[model samples]
Target: MTYTHILTRPVRFFGFAALAALLAAIIFAGAAFGTTVFAAPIERTDVLIGFKNIPGFAEHTLVRAHGGAVTKSFHLVPAVAASLPSAAIRALERNPLVSVVEIDGEFTAIGHSVELDNTWGVAHVGAGSVHHDSVVGTGIKVAIIDTGIDYTHSDLGANYAGGHDFVNGDNDPMDDNGHGTHVAGTAAALLNGAGVVGAAPEARLYGLKVLNASGSGSFSDVIAALQWAVDNGVSVTNNSYGSSRDPGTLVQAAFDNSAAAGVLHIAAAGNEGNCPGNRNTVGYPARYASVVAVAATDKNDKRPCFSSTGPDVELSAPGVSITSTYLGGSYATGSGTSMASPHVAGVAALVMAAGEQSASAVRQILRDTAKPLGDSNHYGHGLIQAVAAVAAVGDSSPPPDDSEPEPEPEPAPEEPTDEPDTTTAVVSDISYSTSGGRTNDRHLTVAITISNGDGAPIGGATVSIDLHRNGSRIASGTGTTNSSGVVSFTLKNAQTGCYSTTVTDVVAEGAQWDGFTPSNEFCK
Candidate 1:
């Protein structure tokens, strides 16, 4: 598709002819590169290119300069997205002007991934509390871009809307396979008699059928689904799919465009649990910047054997033995990164129903309020909690006290005092250590002494200490320097066993004879 944007420039008048030339250049550029290589099973032949900070004219010139043929571009996204031949891709990658170059490839649906013994997954994320407030995703819409959804299912039909079937090139989007209906149920199955309640029970669902009965589809179908979401004003898209080792291609631009257009794209982080064996290997689309990559967790908040782990994994949700709507308007249980993805997608809708409209804003609220577990790889910032996420969406806390940057060292007084008796105090001694004890009773010891410039002990200096436990402030106290110029702070009941937070940010103060920032601090 061709896009025209009338960007405003600085407060300078351009001659009519100069403005005309720029417009004509952009028009020619759009026409010259108006369609991507639409062939199936074609990789390495088409490439997706992105450019940033370059003006429209400059982008046009740069593409042509590298012999790059433009197919299509999503001007709404930060990077000017385009397609190029293999040779142009190499040249573009080598060029300083291009921001990112990725090979355009296809994506296949990766079949993959919660609890109350029967519905623990719903309680795991606290969606019940959100439902109590009537925030059951009443006004939100989530698209399931999978095999297809059985809209006829008693549990899902109430919320099911119309969607396109990319597999058969039709608009009916019915389920030939059961995967889409299963994922759809997890995302937003309706609250009806004799069925499981979804994470966001009232959220709308649409099946943008991409995968066929065998649970697979090409990259182009994925792109078409994304375009459909963008055009249809979809609030969230639950994509329980992926492509292993697929270099990012045309779909990357599509993901970016979808996000920029205010839609959230949630995807399974992949189910190759330890397939790379000790390395966190995330697959394509899910690993893209614009997609919310979700990992899988169980009732006990543990990573299952099949869920992938990596830095790209954003958040985790219940995905083990999950029960949801199925074929024949029935319900069944399944697992995979695919199952894990819908939990987050449902939460996204709940957050939206609570009045968070911006896609970026909803993402931040979810990340900020997620259950913070120590392990990031398995549970990317920890398991997602729906009640917390909902509360965060409507949070009106006092804005953070960003006014205080870390205190800088004070400069020596410029004005000399009349009672100047030259005295400089140095830390005569310093020591710190952790006391051995069981988890219930441990302590931290920090000590410091002040001495005069002449090597004599100083006295009466106010001493203060700040103690932190696990990245949060835990304790602080002030001590007066004794006659011997010594002051100490001991934190009792220090935590022992399992990820102990070491005492950090210990600072000492004197009467300005000398200031000290201890060396033990490893502030990042």
Candidate 2:
């Protein structure tokens, strides 16, 4: 059976009527940011290999990897130049430590790389965290795989190192359907004075156009882009589009291969709702193994009518009336889960920034802290909260000595004997790793611990792992703590170097939430 768990909570405004009536007074309190409504698969190529024994690994062989547990092993060999796969496998079989081996690959969330320029949306998540201290995801490279992004926009120009259009097989990834541009802005718009801010202001953006100008393309183009990203050094790959059909054996294989190389693959849940005519309809890539599918929700924490629903949706974010950078140095507001996917991708970047978190850690933080929407079908978790995401990263990290003193403990209020006041919950003491490395069929293990403010162990708390390097995600996993409040997961067959890992605390809604954020503590 597949493992299932809840990762986020829905954002619920308690008093809509009262709030609306007082809107005039609160007009300047906070502007109503535009909202948009929108909205993974797991696999065995999904299994991380052990480090004890790897086949076909030779010294000096350049190999890419995803989540591996052991970094150093006796049987492990560095990437070396050699065409003798048969000889290498035979030689490895002769060794007692050699058990199994696979080629290294990357699976990253494709995103748009460009200059950071934005307002309402940019700093929403990455700013200020105890873990990362600085905003997470700054100056990271995120690859956008869709129609394309306008590479020359003033906001995106300076940050644009280079990108290619897989659709036309050229360097220009200009957006024709406007979908890619919109998605790009949401992920990494330059934080200049022009439009809005991106989830990662300091992130470097790369545009990989898999979709055509009409907002659609063949699966082959996407596969090609995936290969290109792997061949190049892209860390994250964000896909904001989807279809209801299977991506075919070849395409799925391509995705699997890429993930093995250590790139994160993020996708959008299709916009189709539960219509009577639909039959098992869900978004592609979203339904596929290892993908982080996203959904859409409004400010009220309700699903928009246009947003799709299903098991494929991994999380929810601001999908309605979202303001982002548009083509030609302009800004626009729009809706769709297509708009929501990038926000999560940006959060993934932030998670990577905070610590050496595996893909699973980033995904776990998103789900556990996600505000649960009343309409669970449409809003998978709830509206994605940037502050909360950043906070999750912060909570999992320890504060620097130079930082301000910890906040004084608040006095516990007297409890009413009648009907335990169930509205409060306590969350405290969070920590994680800032891991960034490549794998090569070697096992890499990360140790984690969790506890409550009273120093009691917090059992059953969930943690996420996101393995990323060069601005991409390789693999992800989620695990829960045992009675001891400690758990360990192995990253099998990794490439090596500069990988990140993160952990999070998921408290029930009825208790007070307290903890240090694990935003940024590791990333080299």
Candidate 3:
């Protein structure tokens, strides 16, 4: 669809239009004649066609001269269309004056993301099961680092606490370009009836505009925006843009800083698929080990053609024909990992909302809960499944100390010798490796084994174990060690910093327990 009378520009009156036209014709003819063709190899002519302000055209039509719109540059989009494959794209490049020919990609009109009302739950259409304890991502702030945002849009205004515009170094994130606005909307549009629903309706959104109106930005600008996201209260960031350049220190360092700060950074896997020329060159921060690279998929969970795919991509999300908020209080549909990145960001908010999940926790949950999408390379872990992800954060902490070290046992001579001591002491070795962890924090793992002397099997003995860390007990549990004397328990979010833990036997009194105390450390 075409927008009408979108923008108006003042015109200057010119009396000698005919004379100027005649002089322009003379120069045009001279340049056209000077252009030559080579029959031996390939013939090409670079002609910069300028469409003088045809009245009634919007400002969008007036392409900036600096970006492939100069008066004497070849029109790449039409050139590619006109030149036959047999002629080769290089034919257009044959001309010394011709630079790169950028095919003007077409964009689709988007539906209002407001069709579905808010259930006050963080869920997507196909998001698996609903978590009984709805994760309220309200307080967690997520930064949408992209073009810019229509922060004033009705559906997006409420969640938009505040943001910065690195492109112009301003606070207002007005989208002179529409790309960033849509991305921000997908990540956290207010659950209002005006426009569209976002993945995380309760999340606070920070708009970091790094690209100009043309949906492009310099590497420096993007890096600066990333730094801004980390410096602010943003715990998660979504970057939909990508570049063809190889990985650079500026981008890598930014990602590393965000990771070090325990912030989740999501980036697009670029638009170039498994193409020959650009195959291994995955997008910047996505390829960076620190960032979670997202790929695009359709509703049916199939990888989209335009989506960039590689081992770098961690997961895929619905990106094709995804509807979201646009500039000027409008809605638009876009298809790219750009759209997918926000989905993961919203999911991250949901996971974080469940509890104080670290960045690594959220990443692992997404990876573990993903629906395997055939090939691992294209979909990474698999399609992002929100419900399963939330559920994976079980009410209890994960099992601890898969590695059960042998416990040093003191002789349980108190038991009957010939009876074979049905009741025997059981123990496992445990230890903590870190020190000076987060202040007032605790982290440790325990290992326990149940058995009689001579490595004889001991069964039916209900042994209760408790962990006392930093002079305060953090974990306690009772279970029977089957066949092989082994039991494990976990304690999470106890306290910050290093703490020495001691194991206690609640059953069989004296001579019933045997194990080493392990140290666990916790930090922010």
Candidate 4:
């Protein structure tokens, strides 16, 4: 028996001459150019216009003059989203101020409808163990950028902070489609005893409604949602939506800028995998370097045939028959990379709540601690290990000293015969440098030099450094001094702020530390 395949094609423009005539007739009607004349009707298309420089009043006026209506204006990127006659696209492309004019690409909530069941993803990713350590993503803000969320759901109501709706252009981002609510529940459902709990149960949820009731939306709306998320202090964003085709440079820039602003974007790796061979089928914006692309796995920790695979797949999570919150305060199960993406996003929130604030730091920890699940294309780092990732963060901080100090003993008499005097190590100097071209890539590297009392380099010394930003300790690391008596500490993805580094401790065999305040501070 033969099967019929019905594939959906992207919207295309046609009849350019007729469209031009229609626009001309509308513009020149009742004007000096010509008298009013009827022409063939033309369809308006939504587009994203990228400018060479910061767009302002002149740019807005230019779009208006071309019979275009500006819908969204962005400050992070020099662009404006508008609806205009298809004929005006050529005119805008020819303008010196307009660098790019592309149709706003469409994306959909990527999830396969399935029957409801018990959720095993949380335990599979070790989120349960993380919760035992009190890292339930408390105080971490996660933006669910998809269909709006059911904020009234008992499983998500309390943690639902607030959000914006790009679909209806309203403040209430109530989930019209069940996909966003499901994604939000996977990332952060409440810890109420009656129902299911999320990976980061305590994480604050912000529903940024980009997709509509049909689980479809345009790239321009997604960009607007991203900007809103960044401006509203969202630390992590769960994007379970994307298209197989590229969304263009404008959308890429929006995601990049949002990531640079300290938001960790976790997205689905599109459910378009070909199991017979290794293929590059990952979707954007997940394909972008700035976002973490997650693949879907089954309960047996095996990659599903539908889960897209490529080098961009950063992590894999339980996506098959994963049960989560649905619309109308109900619970449902779904499958796809969509279910997998939120597992990573929730793990990210757990990492942040465990004291890892930097988006890059959280990403590195997730990658470094993931379980090795065979191929990189199938599992990037592997299944995300929330317990291990959060433990890594805990490892960086000093353990609490709760035991009472022992009473000081009387000093013993100095020994008449001594083997040799203990060598004293001192922090001679501290310096720092900034590197990387992009904001998110930029980091702060601090070099600390250790020396002896005679000003000689002291190698083989273990130096502990604490990095602080805005007066709070952000990171701490210990390294052995090399032959040059220097050890460097780097803070990845450093934001614009004041930073300082201090040598907290130094240890060497048969060596003592010289009593001195060794620290340096700088602003970047």
Task: Find the candidate with the highest TM-score and give its number.
Answer: 4
- The Cα error of candidate 3 at residue 385, in Å, is 0.9
> Over the stretch 1-524, how does candidate 1's per-residue lDDT look in tens digits?
11111111122346999978866754664355331111121123555556665224455447645544333333333333333445567777777767777655556666643222365687679998888777788757688999999988889877876787776654678898888898998888876756888899887687899888888875656776777687666889998888887655446777887898999989999988674335676787888888889998878887877888888888999988888888997777887888889999999888887777789999888888899765677778778889888877645853222222113332122211122332544555656555556543365655656676566666665444345555554544444456776766555445543211221111223222322233332221
What is candidate 2's CA lDDT for residue 337? 73
Kindly list the per-residue Cα lDDT of model 3 for residues 1-524, writing each as its tens digit: 11001001122345698758845753564354331111122232222221222111121112211111111111111111111223333443453334333322221111122232222212453332332344436556788877777877888877776766655544666778787788887777765655666776777777777777777665545555655565554679988877665534434555786687788898787777753323453576688888898887776787766677667878888877777787888877777777788888887877776664588888988898888877766888988877777667655875222122112331221221123343334343333322235553343334455555445544444444445545554444444444544544434334454444333331322223221222333332
- Per-residue C-alpha lDDT of model 2 across residues 69-163, encoded as one tens digit per residue: 21111111211111123324444435444333433222222222234322343333323232245554654557888878877677666655456
Looking at candidate 2, the ten consecutive residues that score lowest on lDDT are: 73-82
Clashes of each: 18, 169, 21, 1
lDDT of 1 at 360: 95
- Against the true structure, what is each candidate's TM-score? 0.58, 0.51, 0.52, 0.69
Q: Find the candidate with the highest lDDT and give its number.
A: 4
Candidate scoring better on TM-score of 2 and 4: 4
Instruction: Provide the lDDT at 45 for model 2.
Output: 29
Q: Rate the local accuracy (lDDT) of all candidates.
A: 0.67, 0.54, 0.56, 0.79
Mark the 10 consecutive residues where model 1 has the least summed lDDT: 1-10
TM-score of 1: 0.58
Q: Give me candidate 4's TM-score against the actual structure.
A: 0.69
Weakest 10 consecutive residues, lDDT, candidate 3? Answer: 1-10
